[model samples]
Target: MHTRFTRALVAVICCIVLVASCARLEVFATSTSNTKYSNLDSSKWNLVWSDEFSEDSVDTNKWSFTIGGGGFGNNEQQYYTDSTENAYIENGCLVLNAIQESNGEENYTSAKLSSTSSWTYGRYEFRAKLPGGTGLWPAIWMLPKDINVYGGEWPICGEIDIMEYMGSDRDTVLGTLHYGNPWVYNTGYYDINGSFEDDFHDFVLEWLPGEFRWYVDGNLYQIQQDWYSADSSGTYSYPAPFDQEFYLMLNLAVGGFFPGDPNPADWTSTKFYIDYVRVYEYGGDLTPDSGSSSTQTPNVNLLQNSDFTTDYAGWTTWSENGAVFSVADSTLKADIYTTLPNTWSTQFYQNVDVYSSTTYRVSFRAKSSVSRPITIGVEGVNNAALFNSTFTATPEWQMYTYDFSPSVSCSGAKLLFFLGNVDGSQNVEHTVYFDAYKLVYLDRKREYIFR
Candidate 1:
């Protein structure tokens, strides 16, 4: 009987030791194995792109500003600008502000930004809080990377609206796709517990070859697979637009063809905050891990302070021979008070991100006191010149455009605006003004201009 009692005692001690070892082993666990795949299926998914909006200002490298209030073919009333007052980064989120103000042509001003990157099939996710007010419409959507990726015009190419919220119906969030030969639209919406302005929520799109699923938080809200495109020639089969690559877009529109005007009392200033945008591709290291439930994302812009609205924030200046650089009236101005012609002594420059073997388009507005010439180009910050051109700036403000494609890839490329002509020897004193400098990655094939 004593021997039996001793055996039982020994077993108890063994079990205690085993429990202690397991507690210690937990310290060695890998973070990768513990990643949460949200509540949805993330099998074989790999994270491809993300923008956390951690910077105090928006990064211009991965995004391009889409400026204009041209109704966006929808009769939207808001005039979109690159101004930070209309769009900015605040408290770790992108704030797209829509306010009532007439720039003469439009009664409202808002901001729209588009991603420079495009993808085919992936899981696109975002965390956001909407701006609420009657007649306001905010959208997170995509258009075909190639305006004519399929044969024919838009809708044929396709459109994917991941999420859209209308101020008229502050509690509903919508998902939709526009396709077909004659341009038929399919859409669905889910009601939220409360106004999106009251809290942040997850908006996601799981896009596959033929099937597209829309979800709010973790609940599936919509699914669309059957779509068609009718063209002058013929109607394509299902998935014509769904099959091609598409680039993402974010905009807060006011008074469009869909939503009507707002009551002045209800049309106060409000902001749509986007916390992050994440893109995950299938067949990555992550498998449908049933353990995690969080998501974050990123998108970038190559140039900082391209608008010169932040007091020369993203620019480096240099001058000599009485040349001076300053910001006035929200424009970059260089006054070469003393005569020193053909010298690059006075310059304003910024280094931007670019990829090799890729083409980019640069456009800006500049003017001079006289018909003076200026040199603008893109080169490796400390390396070879990829693009350079000399143009004569007229007295009136004019838009100048040039296309650049680097043979070699680079991340920190220099965008130089030589205030004084580089090759001229005339010592004529003059002033030059610049504003609205925009650089964007171009898909040459789809440079068909627009969808």
Candidate 2:
């Protein structure tokens, strides 16, 4: 009886070990198999715009600064100014300072910045680092420029609040859209929150066909659509007035609606810093494949495309100035002989599943023409997160691979190719050949375990 029991125990332990090993292997396979993608061409959009704060100072051509004391529609108690002392760029960021003192009519002086250019339907994002202190109100918002001329009202023109931080609550940021409505003070407010004053965060607004979505660091926080009703005579009208484009505004208002006036006894300077702002639009011609209904799975094959071969089967060639794309001995080459300082090297275009971030592998074939060092990198549309490599290409064609695993920390990432001075420096110029470019699936389990 004892011998039989021992044999049974041994069998059970062996089965458990086998199951654990299989589970680990499956995770590795999943991690390895997933592929991520993004569109390489940005020209399809009517406008791909951003405010990177690259200017030595704020550009008055693009943004206007509001001045003086007015009702400001919120009973706030700060004087806005366009003066260089109140607002400027330092250390690669826009600074909107709130300083307490007798300046003009108010006890505090700050900056109220706005964009004269407006858009109707698009995606908007701002990368910002905020300030925290008592009696400070910083906001990135939009309002219809011709509201009084066309609709004769505030909410009628529509308002989109991308991000706001009130003095009382430094940790929270809010996003709400105000439209022509009756139940809630001519507008309704929806908000999402994040810990401001700590690190940089991305505030996003996606305005699609009939609905709008708001996100803080790619997390959906609010949605507004034409589902509610409001009447014409300042009453309830279902499906409100959101069909128009709105102008963009940024300001640091002191006190009033939420953050209410600075305390004179414990006064210090507060700063609102913005890193970058970007906007993207739908071309309407490119239709995304939403996946198979029967299979209930995304088509992974659609996410993979590369143009490193001589034939250029999967890519559209983009050559400007002296840039050239041709093949030499089974290697795809981009030749550049530009005397023009502003000329861009050859770029390739591909459509990708940009909305999701799964594991991915992007590899390319390369060989050097000269003995100098070169750089290869990837950049997204209206983005600054660049993944780069500094390698001395050999005479023989060799493969180089890069894997992308996005954690929750990254804002947005995409695939791009470059072969020259990526930082826009005047010195870097090179000729190189590429071939056998491949984007493959990742085995996630093994990926994570190895990591």
Candidate 3:
């Protein structure tokens, strides 16, 4: 018994020693990691590009100002110009200042500048702190180079706003991606909860094949994919406007569509400071992969199951006969399908927990036995419309996807894939086959653009 007591004491001592060693190692590792990339160590990042702002004044060689803007598209009240007084680098940071000095007839003056060169298929990032005022609107966004001459405009060329903030609320930043069938017609915004004035946060935009992601301070906030498709009206078709190259822009405007006019009685000096801008390219082909769900049902299978007789190969729908999964065409394939409307009532439908503020992409194979265009709507609990799209498939198979930016919160929204419009009316239903139905989330973290 004495020997057993000694052995127990030794074992307890050994465990304590092991725990202490682990704690020490963990502290050492963490300190080493933090010291290695102490924010200023741009060496960890391959300084592909930057505007150190070393010159005594703003360098015209690197940037040119956009002059004489009526409303810079935000119904903003400021007139933008290329003047040095409006923008320059002081203390080693580029400053886009918005002042209340009288300029022409306008009550406020600000600066808007852009890189003369255009970049495509690269990661773009900038570290900056925002200015404050009730009507101060500052943005670090990108516009496609072809927008000026090409047929595409706003959403068509695709607008990627890495970071945008209003002076009234200096604590929040907005990251957005604009694209789809109609150029500049659709817009998506994600509000990241953080303070912009407290410290500099890195804003990143990753542009790649078929997808774009926005990040703030290395945390992924939003993503957009499957950008363009054709509907019966053909109004939404904007030939992959974002697939091309775009240029970077920095502007601090006082009042417009978003911020309106500055309050003359309480006008203050608002400045947007940018420490650095970096752009990075994938070392190799890095395509976005499908997402996995950790918050949804544990036993839920993320795969699509269906049966259909139609040629639509890349859809997830069920037919009346033996359920068969199909994916003949490269672009079009079918995984699963069911004829049952209100699929939540059946066991075939999968339950997915989603936030109204979240964004997702759902794809599936779809083909109709009839030649008519079929309308499909996604409904969850409370029968809310998550997404809706209309498509006409040929005799061959074709895959279709409807992206969602939930307008409201949905926790137990079972994925309902069915025919007809959002109102469940105007049913031109005639046995549409669906296969390979899938729901994917786009989780992204912001990275330095020129990294």
Which numbered prediction scores highest in lDDT against the true structure?
A: 1
Better of 1 and 2 by lDDT: 1
lDDT, candidate 3, 117-144, per-residue tens? 7777777878887876787888887777
**lDDT for each residue of candidate 1 in 1-451, tens digit (9 for 90 to 100):** 0001113343343233222221110011111212223334466668899899998887888789977755555556789888999889999999999888997589999888889999998999999999888878888999877776576455466778888877877888877776664444545667867788888999988887556777888877544444556577765554566767888888888875455676557754378999999998887433333211111011123466778775875565655445777788889888776445434556666655566666677788999886777889777522357889998788899999887777665443568887754665245677889997777766665553411
Error of 2 at 150 (Å): 5.5
Model 1 ranges off by over 4 Å: 1-43, 284-451
Clashes (backbone N, CA, C under 3 Å), per candidate, total 23, 24, 57
**Relative to the unseen true structure, what is the C-alpha lDDT of residue 159 in candidate 1, on a scale of 0 to 100?**
78
Q: RMSD, model 1, all Cα superposed?
A: 26.6
For candidate 2, the per-residue lDDT at 324 reads: 68
Which ranges in model 2 have alpha carbons more than 4 Å from their true place?
1-47, 148-150, 181-195, 226-240, 264-269, 285-451
Q: What is the TM-score of each candidate against the true structure?
A: 0.54, 0.50, 0.55
Order of quality (lDDT): 1, 2, 3
In candidate 3 the C-alpha lDDT for residue 130 amounts to 81
Instruction: Name the candidate, 2 or 3, with the larger lDDT value.
Output: 2
lDDT, residue 391, candidate 1: 88
